[model samples]
Target: MLLPFFEWCENTAIGETIRNSLWLFPVIEAVHLLALCLLGGSLLVVDLRMLGVGLKGQRISQVAGYARPFLIGSIVTLVCTGLLLFLSEAVKCYYNTSFWVKITTLPIALLLTFAVRDRFSLRKSFETSAMSRLLGAGSLTLWFVVAAAGRWIGFS
Candidate 1:
């Protein structure tokens, strides 16, 4: 059932149109990389601030506020291109464990972002509280796992 849906997608006008474009895949992939960089970089900056590693003189909310746009932009770019890429190989990715792990971790990452961000906004200190710091560390670890799994998917 799903196979046909994916096949149909691959054969659809839009898919064919994108497939025919000479630089579409490369361009989208480059954008994806750029987005990943921005997301990781922005998050790290904020996390480091939380950990008292970066912007030590700055408030956590201030640092996070400044980085929010970059995070949002990266997420938008990443999701858009990621969907396109997934559609291009939907059936395969649908069954890939790494892809699933990546999917699963996304919510955790989002939750961490909201929780930490909200706390900071609520006048809470961000001086690397044990829980928040753990969350940050876990966030980084999970994302790394997601990327590693994504790479492994190609091999399998």
Candidate 2:
């Protein structure tokens, strides 16, 4: 079932172009990395504020609001470049455990961000709540795992 989709991806013109070009894969990979940096850096700033350790003067909502746009932009860029990169090696990634791990963790991390973490940041009482701190720490940990698994995909 999924095999045909992977085959189609690998045979697509975009995929073929990426696979054939000497610089395209590396360039996309670099873009993906840059997007990852933006996402991670922005998320970290907000998360650290949740943990009550950084941006001491600003409210949680203010800090999170400042980072939200960058976070959203990076997510879009990373997904686009990542999908292109994946198309070039769809069949290989389909069988890669690290790829599966990274894919699985990505949605979980995003859910943590938008569903759990954002709610915590929006609440004025969250600053003193233990659950808020836990969510912040967990969100950071999930994102870290996602990054590690993504890197592991190259080796696996």
Candidate 3:
């Protein structure tokens, strides 16, 4: 159903330019990876706090608040660079199983991070619940699959 759109994206002028350029793809990929790292780190701090591992002294709300800007910024950066990267190889991604895995997991991961995890972490009370540990584990697992699938795309 979406194959035609992927074909159109790969044929876009900017996409062709990026695909043809020696440096553009590499630079964009580097930025994308850096953004991923930033995102992982930002989320990790809060997740660990929720798990009652690190930052025991700080409130979950405080850790989450501190990581908010970084989380938002990294996600923005990732989306921008990811679009450009996809534009360059949309058709290839369409055929790649790893790409399907990434696309499948990415939104779920984001939903967990922002909607469930972030909101849950923001309670004023310092009380840690069993749900917190579940959230932390689930967030980590989904994100790891997303990242790993993204990495597998290169090999695929």
Candidate 4:
């Protein structure tokens, strides 16, 4: 079932164009990297705030508010570019272990960031709690692994 979908993705016009154009693939890959960096930076700011390390003296809500737009935008950009990159090499990715690791971790990390960490960050009571610290640390670790796994895909 999934094999057919992967095959279909590889046969799509955009996928074919990406694969055939030597420059297009590299350009998209670079965009994906830049988007990841933006995403990581934005999340790091919020996470560090949650951990009470950075932006000390500022309200958690205030710090998070500053990073929220960039975080959301980067997520959208990364997902779009990531999907395009995946389509360009669907078959190879289908068999890649690092690809699977990244795919699995990406959603988990996103959920930890947007659902768990963001919710806690918005509540003043939870801002300095142990739970907040744990969530902050976990989010950072998850995203770090996600980025590492993504790089490993190139090697594998």
Q: How well does candidate 2 match the true structure in TM-score terms?
A: 0.94
Scored by CA lDDT, what does every candidate get?
Answer: 0.74, 0.89, 0.92, 0.87
* Error in Å for residue 12 of model 3: 1.0
lDDT of 4: 0.87
TM-score of each: 0.82, 0.94, 0.96, 0.94
lDDT of 2 at 117: 85
Q: Pull out the clashing pairs in model 1.
A: none
Which ranking of candidates, highest TM-score first?
3, 4, 2, 1
Please give the TM-score that candidate 4 achieves against the real structure.
0.94
89 in model 3: Cα distance from truth in Å? 0.5
Question: Comparing 2 and 3 by lDDT, which wins?
Answer: 3
Most accurate candidate by lDDT:
3
| lDDT (Cα, tens digit) per residue for candidate 1, span 1-156 | 567877776777766666778888778878888888898898888777666577778776777788888888888888888878776667777678888788888777777667655565335465557665676676677677766776676777
- What would the per-residue lDDT of candidate 3 be over residues 1-156, giving only the tens digit for each residue? 999999999999989999999999999999999999999999899888888898889889999899999999999999899999999999999999999999999999989888888778887774467988889889889989998999899998
Clash total of candidate 2 = 0
Clashing pairs in 4: none
